[model samples]
Target: MNNWKPRVSMGIPVYNGENFLREVLDSLLAQTFEDFELIISDNASSDRTEEICRSYAAKDKRIRYHRQEINRGPAWNFNRVFELAQGEYFKWVAHDDIYAPEFLAKCVEVLDRDDSVVLCYAKTKFIDSEGKILKEYDYQIATDSPQPAERYRSLVLVNHRKHAAVEIFGLIRSDALKKTPLLGYYARGDSVLLVRLSLLGRFYEIPEYLFFNRDHSQRSVKEKQVQIARGRTIVAKFLGMGPLPPTEWFDPSRKGKIDFPEWRLFYEYFISVKSFPLAVKEQISCYLYLGYWLFKNWMKLVRDLLIAAEQLVRASYKAQKIIEISLEKRF
Candidate 1:
């Protein structure tokens, strides 16, 4: 009897997110846009997450809940939701974020009107755990530029401290999004996803601030704090002037491995440039922009190498200690 099709499919990937899950579900269910389907992918949460999702799904026909048998990383769960989506327009909703009632209606309107615009999002404000607005994201990227290279360049040199590139959470044409790798299991993979998407088509940002990003201790970017609490790391000791980026948050399997996150960004950006079908001049311009990026991030690039060497050395020492203990036990 279920023959209804939705114009938009929204997916929320979550893990142990009981604290804010109810509020997010309420906001989406209240949205002015009624044709959208809501998909929740639970990453094997041990909390009351299952109970909450099941209860919501029971009440709403639009809500679909899928629980993982085992916890993969956030990136894996993010992709899982997209795979399950059947709508023309797709949105990856964060478990902790809130949206205004008109958020989805406005985005779908823009996408419906313009074929060139591949993604549409509203301006965002950062909110604290108590739902108080901390500040608006005033950072601008010329994402609406008609030229692909110009859009790509605008996203490449972002002041991440000021701009979160939250547009990646926006409504995107499923076809355009499918062209780029849907978020990778590497650090800063979400950033790469936005940058690459800019090459495919223009992005539209609604003037009003309709997206509210939640900032709390449980957020993934703050997962570094948990790592720091365990002990000092090669990245913290040798790398200069920053908190450790959340590698394990993207993929828990990356824990204790030697990772060149900055280097990976450089590689992926280069690949994005090479793979796209842009004019020769625009392609050259994109490469020049990357050169500028390397000039700015050369220090971090070097740090990646240093951190890798230190990690390898520590891993070797640990392995040697284990072998010695094994020999003593045998004797």
Candidate 2:
């Protein structure tokens, strides 16, 4: 790549993504909008990921591939691509997802005409591992609202998994993105980031379904225990707290503590509103909404705790059984 700058920067953060990396890259390369730079941050994949990326980089001048010396977690890898981006608009592409050739062109057109729009994404269709269209996903979050409070309420109160958080992969204004913490190293961090961006400006959604999000078993959102562990690791890294016990890590009863991921999300939302410029009425309204949000999600919090407890009990029972079998064999 020369000293040329592009209007948009597309970053794909992959880890051991050799399976669909080529297909994703091919889709990106076929984009009608060619004046964009594609940055691939490989998280030290031991698979064919490095080979595939390097081969593409050699052929395409716009493609820049960087391999980490060691594997950083998904959060770091995702943020690294944006940090190295050199474009007015930036987007994160998942290696397993497919984008239509016109995805970039349409998103760029929207962002160009609307200065008030800080982020733009198209409707999403969920695809299976075989690339078969599963269903069209309807993420009914109110990010499109002109009112910041409405946007914030939708982002903060709505269940992120239900909404799919597809907007996290949308084309974002680099300036607006820089103003907020890109992504925190916690579960549902993408949702919190979206909330922050909604506070900054409105999000525009293309009516067409140009983005295809692949839903598979390996997706991070599907792994509840893994998410808990990742959130704990992040908390420990930042707070200088030694590794947290499993009980403390996933317990919603311990609100206001670093271990509670949901509480941390609300705290982040509160900080975003407090730090930003808002009218007194808006501020009061947001705080009131926050209370409403807590009240509304109280049962959901209990359900989460029950699920976590069930998982823990199952794990402990499995461990005890394994030990018993081992003892019986020894005897």
Candidate 3:
């Protein structure tokens, strides 16, 4: 084999995505920038996802497809794609999203020209399941700010934009992404990632609508999020949305554990802040901004604690009942 590495690595972490997979693949393959590798990690999907991936991989030298023996959850799959990537730059695209032909070319141009820019993403338009444009996302966070603290504060308030974490899909410096925890297995981890990336360097937003985010009822954020309290998670909190997802959504190993997503998100943000080396003033500003976050999310934080306590009580009751049954049977 030849030791060939592409300029950019596009990773698609998908599960049961056959329905709209073709549209995304076609869009990426048709990108004006052809010097990129496409890596797809299938999460043991029972649908025709495997067949579809194999078909595409066979035809395209740039495509690499991998299927897991069992479901490893979204976090593992998301990180797996990155581990397999050998490109100078990276981007994570959802299987259901569509991109314009200039998306990759434009993003690569920005990253190549600006060493200070850690990530570059185009303006986004939300599309329905049938590929019809629902609305265009015009709000732009100050991610391009030269001040890291300002970037952090802007991303923390991304929920006010009433859009999901679209910037997370932007072309990013592989080294910068590697410095942070690549997507944690907690609710709203993507936002945490963007904030961390911003701390590393600047973010550039192209002034064109080249990215399309498909909003469907079956999407994970919508489907699993509804199981929790509405308007509580990062994606939904702005709309008074629900709380974190249950176990096994992000990682299967964390099954049956009490998940305090809001609290987890709160703690992760602090960890990101502590991990980065900022000026004393910048660090203090970040901390101060976090205090504002705490005040705003105090309700969600309280809910997390209450939820954990309830789960503990339920677990104790179940364990006691099981033990009683075993003892009675022995007698």
lDDT of 1 at 291: 97
Q: 1-331 in candidate 3: lDDT tens per residue? A: 8899899999999999999999999999999999999999999999999999999999999999999989888889999999999999999989999999999999999999999999999999999999999999877688889999999999886664375788999999999988988988876778889889999999999999999999888877633554664334343444464556764567779776767778778888898888989999999999899999999989878776666666688689999999999999999
Q: After superposition, how far is residue 219 of candidate 2 from its true place, in Å?
A: 2.4
Taking all chains together, each candidate's TM-score versus the true structure is: 0.94, 0.81, 0.93
Q: What is the C-alpha RMSD of each candidate to the true structure, in Å?
A: 1.9, 7.8, 3.3
Stretches of candidate 3 exceeding 4 Å from the true structure: 221-226, 229-241
Clashing residue pairs in candidate 3 (N, C-alpha, C atoms within 3 angstroms): 229-242, 230-241, 230-242, 231-240, 231-241, 231-242, 232-241, 232-242
Q: Candidate 2, overall lDDT?
A: 0.81
Candidate No. with top TM-score: 1
Model 2 per-residue lDDT tens digits across residues 1-331: 5589999999998888988898899999999999999999998899999999999999999999999998776778889999999999999999999999999999999999998899999999999888999999887878888788888888877864477789999999999999988887665678888888998899999999999999877664424554455435333445443321322322224423334455556678788888678778777877888889889766545444544455567678989999999999999
Candidate 3 lDDT trough over 10 residues, lowest sum: 230-239
Give candidate 1 regions above 4 Å deviation: 226-231, 243-246
RMSD of candidate 3 to true structure, Å:
3.3
